[model samples]
Target: MNTVTPPKERAAAPETAPASRRSLLKRPRQLWAVTGPLVIFVVMLAIVAGLTPTFLGSNGLTFIAAAAAPILLLALGQALVLNIGSIDLSNAAIAVLGAILLAFLLAPLAAAAPLLVLLIVTLFGAVNGLLVAYAQVPSFALTLGTLGIFQAAALVLSGSTTVYVSANGEAISALYQSGILGIPMTFWIGVVLAIVLWAGLRFTRLGLAMTAIGNNESGAIFSAVRNRRVKVVVFALSGFTAGLASIAIIAQSGSASATGAGGDLLLPAITAAILGGTSISGGVANPINVIFGALTVALVPIATTAIGVDAQAQNLVYGLVIIVVVALTMARTRGAVVK
Candidate 1:
C-alpha cells in the first residue's frame, strides 16, 4: 500500500544526493588550494635544475633563500593587506622611507633607531586604516595617495640620493650578513614572522574577524566582529612588516635610496602574495605557502639568466608568470567578485 509521505520530509530527502555530490566535487578544489602552489614551485625548481645541473647545490639553494627573504617579507605585508580585502601599494614605499629614516637616525638613536622607524611606519599604516574604516575611503585610492606621500618624504629626507649607513651600520648589517644555525638572519627573521602570523590567523580572534570581514562584511558585522578595529591592526601589521623589510634592504645594500628596493619590489611582492594562494577577491591567505611563492619569484630572473634570456625577456617572463599564476589561484566561488 502506497502511503502519502509528509511534504517536508519528501522534499528534504532529495536534497542529500546533490549535496553529497557537491561535497565530492569540492574535495579536489580544496586539495588543489593546499598543494597547487607548492607543486608549481617544485616543478619550476626541477626545470631549472635540469637546465643548470648545479641548481640543487647548497650554494644555489642558499642564494635562492637569501634573495627570496626580502621579497617574502614584503609579500607578508602584502598578504596581510590582501586578506582583509584591501591592498597596500605603499608598503614598498613605506620600506624605502623607513630605511632612509633608520639610516638618518642610526647615529643618534643607536640601538633604538630600528624600533623608532618601525613605530613610525606602523602609525603611518594606522592612519591609512583610519581613513579606510571611518572615513569610508577605498583602500586602493588611499594607499596610492600615501604611496606618493611616502616617496616624496623619502626624497626630501634622502635629498634624492642614497643614504649610506656609515654610523651604526653593523646594527642593520647583521640582519643580512649574520646567520644563526647556518641560515641567513634575514631569512630566519622572515621564517619566524611567517610562523607567528600564520599562528595568529589559525588561532586568534583578530584573524577570524579579518577572514569574516573579507568574506562578507555585512555578515561579519551581524556576527559582532569589530571590522574596523581589525582593519587598523591589519594595516598596522603591514606597516611594521614593511619597516622590517626596509631593515633587510638596508642591511643587504648598506644604504637606502628613493629608487632602490622599494620601487622595484612592489610588483614582485604583490605577485608573491597572489601566487601564494591569497585570493584577490579577499577572504583567503596562506602565509607559509607565500614563502614558496617568493622563492618561485626569486628563481625566475636567475633561471632566465641561466638560460641565456635577456633582461627584457626576463621581464616578459615575469608578466606571463603573474598572469598564469593569478588565473590559476583566483577563487572562483559563486558570487565572488575580483574587486
Candidate 2:
C-alpha cells in the first residue's frame, strides 16, 4: 500500500540577514517616506509664511515647537504601538493620570516623581500586554475598555480639578524656553527622541522581532521569535512615553486637569502618526517622518490664529491635509511592493 505524503512547510525568511539595514536605507520607497512629509511641511510653511510674514520667523517657529512637543510624544507612543499591529487607546488618559500623579508626587518625591510615574505607567501597559498577548483579546476592545476605566479613575482620584505642581513651570519648562540655533529646545528634544526610536527600531534585535511579528505573525512564529515578550516590551515603551508626555503637558499648561483635559490629544496624536507614514494596519513606522508630520500638524492651529482664520475653516483644511498625507504614504508603500 502506498503511504500518503505530507506536504513540507515553507521556510521563514532568515532573521539575521543584513538586508534589513539596506532595506531600510536603500529602499526606493524610503525616499517617498521622507519626501511626502517634507513636501507637505514645506508647502504648509510657505502658505503660512505668505499669509503671515512672521509664522516662520524666530519666535513664531518657537511657538510651533512648543505646541508640538507633548502631542509629538503622544504620537511617538501611538506610532510604536501601531507598528506592532496594536493600539493603545489609553495613551492620553495615561498621560493625564501621570500628570496628576506627578503633580501630587513631585511635592514629596521631587524629581523622582517622574520616574515613579513612568514605572506606574509601564505597569499599566504590562497589564494591557498580558491581556492582549496571553488572553488573545482584541487590542481595540481591550484598550477601549481600559480607556474608560483609566479616564474615570483619573477624574475620581483627582476630584475632577486641575492640579498644578509648584515646580511645573520651573526647570521643567527649560526646554520650552531655551533654543539653540534659534530652534526651541522642545523641537530639539523631539528630534533626539526620534533618533532614539529610529535607532531602536532599526538596529536592535528586539526591533527586528517587533517588525517580523507585525508584518507576518506566522512567519515570526516560524522563526522562533518571542512574540509575547516583545509585545510586553513594546507596550511598556508606549506607556513610558505617555508618562514622559505628561511632563510636557504640565510644563505647557503649568497644571493638569483631573478630568483628563489633554485626553483630547489622542486624535491629533493618531493623526500625526498616520501623517508620518505609519500604517494603521501594522508593519510600518518612521519616527523621523513622525517629527516632520508633527511639525506640520502643530503649525496649522498657530497658522489659523495668526491669519485670523476661523476654527471651522482650519478643521476643514486639517482634514484635507491629513487625507492627502495618508493617501500619499499608503500609495508609496503599495508601490514599493509592486516594484
Residue 182 error, candidate 1, Å: 5.0
Off by over 4 Å in 1: 1-26, 180-182
Q: What TM-score would every model get versus the actual structure?
A: 0.89, 0.87
The pairs that clash in candidate 1 are none
Model 2 Cα lDDT, one tens digit per residue, 24-54: 5776666676678878878888887898886
Q: What is the lDDT of every predicted structure here?
A: 0.84, 0.78
Identify the runs in model 2 with alpha carbons over 4 angstroms from their true place. Answer: 1-30, 167-169, 331-339
Q: Which ten-residue region of model 2 has the weakest summed lDDT?
A: 1-10
Model 1 agreement with the true structure over 1-339: per-residue lDDT tens digits:
012446975776667678756654677876677777788888888888888887667567677777888889999988988988899899889899998998888888888999999999999888888888998889999999999999999999999999888788887788777787555799888888988988998799988788888777888999999999999999988899888888888888888999886677888888888888887757888898788888888888877877667877888987787788768765567543335
Winning model by TM-score: 1
Q: What is the lDDT of residue 324 in candidate 2?
A: 74
RMSD of each: 6.2, 6.4
- Estimate the lDDT of model 1: 0.84
Clashing pairs in 2: none
The TM-score between candidate 2 and the true structure equals 0.87
